[model samples]
Target chain A: MTLTEKVLARASGKAHVQPGDNVWVNVDVLMTHDVCGPGTIGVFKREFGQHAKVWDQSKVVIIPDHYIFTADSMSNRNVDILRSFVHEQKLPYFYDVIDDPTGEWKFDASKGQLERQYGSNYTGVCHTTLPWKGHTRPGEILFGTDSHTCMAGAFNQFATGIGNTDAGFILGTGKLLIKVPETMRFFLEGALPLGVMAKDVILHVIGEIGFDGATYRAMQWEGPGVYSLSMDDRMTIANMAIEAGGKNGIFPCDQKTLDYVNERVAENGTKSEFEPVEIDAAQVFSYDKVFDLSKLEPTVACHPDPGNRKLAKELEHIHLDRAYIGSCTGGKTSDFLAFAEVVRGKTVKIDTVGVPATTKVVRELKEILWGGQSVWQILQSAGVQLTENASCAACLGGPVDTFGRLNKPMKCISATNRNFPGRMGNKESEVFLASPYTVAASALTGRITDPRTFMS
Target chain B: MAHTVTSPVYVVRDNIDTDQIIPAQYLTLVPTIAEEYVKLGSYALIGLPDALYPKRFISEGDISTPYKIVIAGRNFGCGSSREHAPIALGAAGVEAVVADGFARIFFRNCVATGEVYPYDSPVRLCDVLHTGDVATLDFDVDTLTVGGTVYSLKPLGEVRPVIDAGGIFNFARQSGMIAGEAPSH
Candidate 1:
């Protein structure tokens, strides 16, 4: 059996399973955010009675990462509902936004104290924070309310998203009936060219396979190139699996996964006893199909469809009015490092926006120096509009009043996932999905230019 | 438990995501309120395609418009697991959807909510069915008649009961999966 089958079988307490076979699997974790959590709670109450409690409080994680900082009353009300639900249930894993109560700036650098006491309870971009906070583990079955919950599959887990009603049922039953998805393996065998990142590789794959090419299948990455990718890069690939109609995208666990999890756990001042999941050598040949990504180039998904990809060098004539470099798919630390490499010492010619995935990433950015100044300061000086709060702002093409919303029709090159119509803002606006390197390069050149031209 | 209907087929291309079905901007409406849902449903498929399709499911300046069936290409609902997509369509009077394929989550949502009958076509239904073409769908016989041709639809299998009971919650309650009077709320 494939890795996905093995994991699902183990979770379901079955010795074997096949594609299209439905089984009730035990859920290790269930996550929801402000946008869907309130609806899930409503469904839970309506179906299971008002006084019903979740099956397990510790296994549930709730975060209000979307629409938190917006002035929309409905968005704020959703967060309030989640807060009251957390209070009523006494849930331990709720990550709420922290506000400086005293509003005083007293710096004690020697004591490692900053001016404002921004509490550490918040978890920005739940997909990125899940692994940072030690919620994702190999061989586990995790579920979230967001489509990109498949991002957790980078840790070699079977993770996917469900609708509010299914989530409510899971909340009450602690289990889900899922059909085992067949695995489609992609053997990445060559080294990516300089300035080409995992985002480009995935976009190339999506281009080869249209949006519905891998419907109801698990996309498994393997071989030398897959092993060579950083966890951030792997997460970027897994996060956009749904864009290609994949059930999930997974990379088998290796030393890199273990090392990253260990470092994150240590940074949190905790000792983790989590062990890496072992795979059978004979199970490697069980993939239903395989694709090769040896000759891939820096690619970009053009307006309206993520599968409508072209080589970055082929689309240099397309001018960009805005460049955004942030999201669960592109807002990691390594993504920023790549962005800085291309944007260093260059002024942006277009409206650029940069947002770190998490608060921890923000703290790390403050300590890094770029051109004799903090990386954050350098980006700001380069005319990149950095939002203060970390949330899913404008990624979903929210209402007109949303921050970073496309007020007028303009072409944009974004590092985020999905380029569906009206995805980033105005319905007439065109969005090109690319890597941070490509986005940064395009921002400097005001067009979709390949990063290799700008790289040192 | 099953019924047949004939209506004019509204053709849409592939990958009609939930975001396009009902943008996240209108997701705040309470799901239990019919008027709120009807108001939110008015904007279904708004700003999606330029021409060759009806931009809005609910007619402008009028709340009631007859639209019973939608025929689409492959992967009819491919992004996001928002039930609001089906809710908006159902409220807009879309009774059934026929496509070459569907995203698993959306297909399940169709069965769980009983809001729309999701049928799979062997061939690209969008290619065979055209806008304003009268199509007949028989759930009992699992066949679709469009453009003077009869096509067999993939059987619903175990999903039929969920739709027959008018939703998953109703099926679960009636089947004794849960013990209690179904909560009215």
Candidate 2:
């Protein structure tokens, strides 16, 4: 049996579940957030005819990360919906916030108000919150209401996002249907060539497989690539598994994963050693699929869609007006480390936007890049616009705005997942999706260029 | 009721998104009827916000030659899940949108509101609706017709009857069943 079947079996207390089988499995974890949460709870209540025994309230995670600043009125209204739901459900585990109690930050109340309005507390963003806060463990299936919920697959678990209607259905029944998808193993071999990060590998795979190639299949990554890449990089790849029509994308538990989890939850006394799941050697696979790391280079998915991919070397002569790298997809520690290593001493050209995931990432990268741990000073000298605390702004267009078509169509190299038309800041501005390293290289050069030049 | 009509049809290119079908800017401004919504939103969809959108179906985009029906190419309705796409199409006075493909979710939603109908064969479609010809469909959310004529297509193979009964909520009541009491899955 495949690892997916085995994992499902282990979680469901069954030996195996078939393609056509319908098993009544209890939900292990239930997650909802922000705009959709209120309406979903409302619908769940209406559907069940009354408040029944919830499968487990403790497992319910409600994080509000979308409308962070309440900068726009629409976001404020959305926050109102979340507040109403949090109060109605009396939910407690809603993390993802920046509120500090002391007067050292008087505006903390304003930030707290934003959190109360949006339903986040002194925790953090949802995707980073669940795993970072030690809630997730191996050998479990988690269901969330966000499309990017598949990010949990990086922790070696099966996770998928359902629509609001499906979420309501699950919330009411504590059960959901699954057609135990067949598994597809991606055995990547060879040390990654210079400048090619995990993000590039996944983008190349998507380009080869098309956006929906792995539809209804669980993509399991087991190879030399898994060991070299960091957890954050693994997440960036797995998060977009849904876009490829994958049920989930996962990597097996390794020492790096165990150590990372152990350090964070060590004080919580949480054990990091999970009953690691192993693949059966007898299972007949596609025989074996191999990708040569030496042949692969940095890739860019030209805008209008994520599937419009091409090698960065192919677009070497192309010019760029923006370089963005911050979102749930590529916004993590190692993404910045790879980026700073590319742009540390080099000066960024004018009109470049280099944003990390959080203020924390910015501080780390600033120290790495500017040699002062304060990025603003080095960025001011480097002329790279830095927007801190505006998380997801590089990808989302509320604060750290990208290009507007009115002002000469801007061509950008972004680390965000989707590159759909009008997705960046402009309907006409061309956005190129690439790894963080590729984006950082473009920022320094003022155009779309390959990152292999800077790598050792 | 068994409905049948044969007509030639007009054709639309695929990859039309929901935002194009009905720009969010026009949802509140225009009248809610499918015809007016179509009149107001169709131009914006074809990337002609100033020209054909506010006016009636006149340009080549709205070819009125052989018939009034429309047959679209692949992956129709590819953007946001706003209910406005079907609303605008139905209100824009469009009779039907016969596509080789449709977004699974949007198609399901459209089937619920009785604004559009899905058909398989090109014979019955071409009989009453010619390629590039303007066609009209009188859709009942259960049955659709070309130029006020119903095309003869077999009963739905396997979409939930709920979508046909004006969406899940309405279908539940119309099936002589009460809410909070759906039959076992």
Best by TM-score: 1
Task: Evaluate chain B of model 1: give its TM-score.
Answer: 0.90
Give the Cα error of residue B134 in candidate 2, in Å.
5.4
Clashing pairs in 1: none
Q: Model 1, range B1-185, lDDT digits (tens) per residue?
A: 43888887778888787877777777776565557768766766664655536445556775543558888887787788778778778777787888888987788888877888888888787876667788888888988887778989898889888887878788888999877777763
Query: What's the TM-score of each model vs. the native?
Result: 0.93, 0.75
Q: Give me the overall lDDT of model 1.
A: 0.80
Q: After superposition, how far is residue B71 of candidate 2 from its true place, in Å?
A: 5.8
Candidate 2 chain B has its poorest 10 consecutive residues by lDDT at B44-53
Model 2 per-residue lDDT tens digits across residues B33-148: 23544455343343212222243334556522233345665455643334456645655445456764565335644654455565543333433444444343333343445455
Over the stretch A228-254, how does candidate 2's per-residue lDDT look in tens digits? 777887888788775555667777778
Instruction: Indicate the DockQ of the complex predicted as candidate 1.
Output: 0.58
Docking class of 2: incorrect
| Winner by lDDT | 1
